[model samples]
Target chain A: MSEFEPKIVAYCCDFCAFAAADLAGAMRLQYPPNVRIIRLPCTGKVDAIHLMKAFEQGADGVFVAGCLEGQCHYLEGNLRARKRVAYAKRLLAEVQIEPERIDMFNLSSAMGGRFAEIVKEMTQRIKEMGPANTDRRQQPVES
Target chain B: MIVADRKPLEEILDSIKDYKKIMLMGCGGCVTICFSGGVKAVELLASQIKIARKKQGKPIEIIECTPERQCEFEFIDAFKKDLESAEAVLSIACGVGVQTMSERHEDTITIPGQNTKFMGYPVEHALWEERCAGCGNCVLEWTGGICPIARCAKKLLNGPCGGSSNGVCEVDKDTDCVWQLIYDRLKKLNKLENLMVVRQPKDWRTSTDAGQRRVKFEEAML
Candidate 1:
């Protein structure tokens, strides 16, 4: 049987994760291509709606990558983003969705290798869990 | 202003478990000022509901709308058009707003998304303490601005009970003794002599005990 390729969405801070991804490319550090990145100005700006929407839009896993603690470009943007991520996890668990599918990572702008590692780890985890069975993407309507 | 807090997300989601199309109605009056039933709260509830319903394999449709004020008929009238397609409404206003919505739209079931606490003002950000009971009596002349009915642990009209110790109430060490507060405030305003004059017991009939208070203004009336 062919392995399932989990669709992962990564909401990345433009100043850190996005920059690190670009630097990874320059450094020729290879990572799984299954992860699609969405650049956000600050992690704080990413609302709970965005994470839910990504899942609704067929993302098997969603991850938010922000700057290291106390290094947020917009003061406490990363801290706020951390709080939102924690809240989203609890909310996801209430709906029977495995909170593990959603993850938050903290890394500096220079840690290209850590960013790549997170993508691989998240992709592997989602592959084991299989596809999401959320209300927006149910398998089939039972007759 | 009235104070309230948002109902738990689980309770709200459970209330509309069978409904497919839901409208989150926010009030921009007291609830808005208290950060419980404002636009931000409506948006938060909407997001939580959508995420929750999605996990349950139910494709629920949620629409967010905020009325200028949910306590009045005219203010709630603005939501009639938006209610055309919604199966139910989750009102994030105070008790008055919830009743108003139910009265205006008898056919649509209105669920309260907040717990109406009391008529009080914000003491700090997101923190509100009861200040008045609306007893239809103003006793500030004797007790200063501190309301014994609302602030006193025992609601003592005469003076502080024996529970007061060092200006703090024994019922709650964090709370300042209402009588002590009254004394300090009265002393500051040079009204300490008024405290010595014993006032008669309050007339409960004129207060909420009268049952359903009403007010009419001759100048405002046609």
Candidate 2:
């Protein structure tokens, strides 16, 4: 059987993680191609519904990458993003999905290597969890 | 506002497990103000249920709608087309909205997604506390706007009952003794005499225990 290539969606803040991803390309850093990046004006715009919709649409994993904690370019967007990410994680957990399937990370635009590392880390995590919805099909019915 | 709490997701999922599609309704009235039933809540719940169903390999479809007031037939009647297509309805509004939908559409199965908690107001940013019992009587004039029927542990009319300690209810240490609040407010207003005039028992018929209550305005009848 072929290995499961989990699909990861990364919501990146334009001021930090998005630029960091760009920088990773410029640095010739090799990371898994499994993750797709969606650049947002600010991570604060990352609503819990948006994250769940991604999972509902078929994302194996999702993560929000924003400015390093106190360094949000828009002054508290990342903070709000972090709180929303935590709330989304709790919601996902209630649906029997792994809380680890969604996450939030902090990075500087200059930290291209860290950005690449986050992607690889997320990819690894999803691979371990298997695909979000499909994995249920493999289990025996409890009832 | 009528404050309510979303039923746990597991309970909500179980109620509509038999349906393949449903109209997930939200109210733009009191439940919206309380954050239990609103457009934002409806969207999040729909996505959560969809993802949960997908995980079980039984993907259910959902149609999200938020009316200005689900408890009003006129607003709900606007989406009769969607109503006819959906197999069931999962309402995130307060109890009144749920009952209203079921009453209007007798053929469609309507399920509640929240537990209507109380007639209350936001006590803080995200906290709501029961402020009124809807007892159909106005006792606030003498009680300084705090209702013992709703806020007090014993529902005592004139009391600092022995259970009140350090200005907090013994029922729950976190709750302030309503009688204490009344006394302080009345003392501030120099109307402590109102507390001394309690000579008769309250009419219990005004409360819910008597039966379902209704009001009709003869002049408003068409």
Candidate 3:
């Protein structure tokens, strides 16, 4: 059997992490191609519902990537995003999904190498965890 | 506003486990403001239910609806058409909203998704503290806007029960002795004499002790 390639979703803020991803591409930094990046104007815009929706849509893992602490373009957007990410983690755990499936990372636009490192790190973690077993059921029994 | 907390996901899942489909109703009033039963909350819960149920091979359909005010008859009437399609209803509103939905939808099985906590306001984002006991008497005039009935340990109408220490209630260390707060606030306002005027024994008839109470709006009558 072929090894499982986990599908990871990254909600990256345009100000930092999204820009960092762009920088990684520009600098030719190699990271796993398993992650699909969704860019938002700010990390604060990434809500708990959005993270859960990503999982519902077949993401093996999800992460909210924002700017470093106290450095949000919207003053406290990154901080707020971090709090929401924690809340989403708790919510995921309640549904029996591994809380490690979701996480939050802080980075700066200048850290292209660091962004690549994080992508590799998260990809490796999720690959080790394997694809979500919740996906085993494809047919929803209709009454 | 009436603050509430969502019941445990397991408890809620168990309640409608037998049903194949249900209407996930949300309230746009207090529960919405508290982040317990708003549109976003309904969406999150629906996703969770789907994910959880799908894993167990028992996926259920959820028809989501958020009325402007679930307790209001006119607002709830808007969802009558949607209710026909749902086998049951999971109302994520306060107890009043659940009762209202049940009373209005006589044929449908309506269940609560939240536990109505108390008449209170949010202290901060996602944190709520009780502010009123609904004693049906206004004592804020003398108590400096604090309700001793709700905040005090012994519901003392007069002064501190003396069980308080350093302004903390003896019943619970985390609670502030409301009488002490009332004293300081009244003293600041130069109204310490308000405490000296002994209050008459409270009439319990206005409270829950008298059973369900109703207020008739003569102006709104047909």
Give candidate 1's whole-model lDDT.
0.85
User: How far out, in Å, is residue A137 in model 1?
Assistant: 3.1
**Which runs in model 2 stand beyond 4 Å of their true positions?**
A134-143
Model 1, position B9, has a per-residue lDDT of 78
Instruction: Report the C-alpha lDDT of model 1 over A67-129, residue by residue, as the tens digit.
Output: 999999899998988878887787667666789999989988899998889999999999899
**Of candidates 3 and 1, the better by TM-score:** 3
Task: Estimate, for each residue in B125-221, the C-alpha lDDT of model 1 and write its tens digit.
Answer: 7688999888888776568778998888777888888999999999988899999988888889998887778778889877888899888898999
Best by DockQ: 3
Error of 2 at A5 (Å): 1.2
Q: Among these predicted structures, which one has the highest TM-score?
A: 2
Could you report the Cα RMSD, in angstroms, for every candidate shown? 3.7, 3.9, 3.2
For model 2 chain A, give the 10-residue run with minimal summed lDDT.
A134-143
lDDT string for model 3 (A1-143, tens) is 87877888999999899999999999999899888899999999988999998888778899999999999999999999998999989988988999998999999999999899998999999989986766643542222
- Writing each residue's lDDT as its tens digit, candidate 3 over B1-222 gives 999999999999999999999999999999999989999999999999988887787889999999999999999999898889899999999999999999998999999999999999878777899999898877898888888888876778988987889999888898888888999999999998899899888887888899999989999999
Candidate 1 wrongly placed segments (more than 4 Å): A1-5, A55-60, A96-103, A124-132, A136-143
Clashing pairs for predicted structure model 2, backbone only: none
iRMS, model 3 (angstroms): 0.9
Per-residue lDDT for A1-143 in model 2, tens only? 88988888899999999999999999999999988899999999999999988888778899999999889878999999999999999899999989999999999999999999999999999999898873333432232
Candidate 2 CAPRI assessment class: medium
TM-score of 1: 0.86
Candidate 1 CAPRI assessment class = acceptable
**DockQ of candidate 1, scored on C-alphas against the true complex (2 decimals):** 0.36
Task: Judge candidate 3 at residue A131 and give its lDDT.
Answer: 69
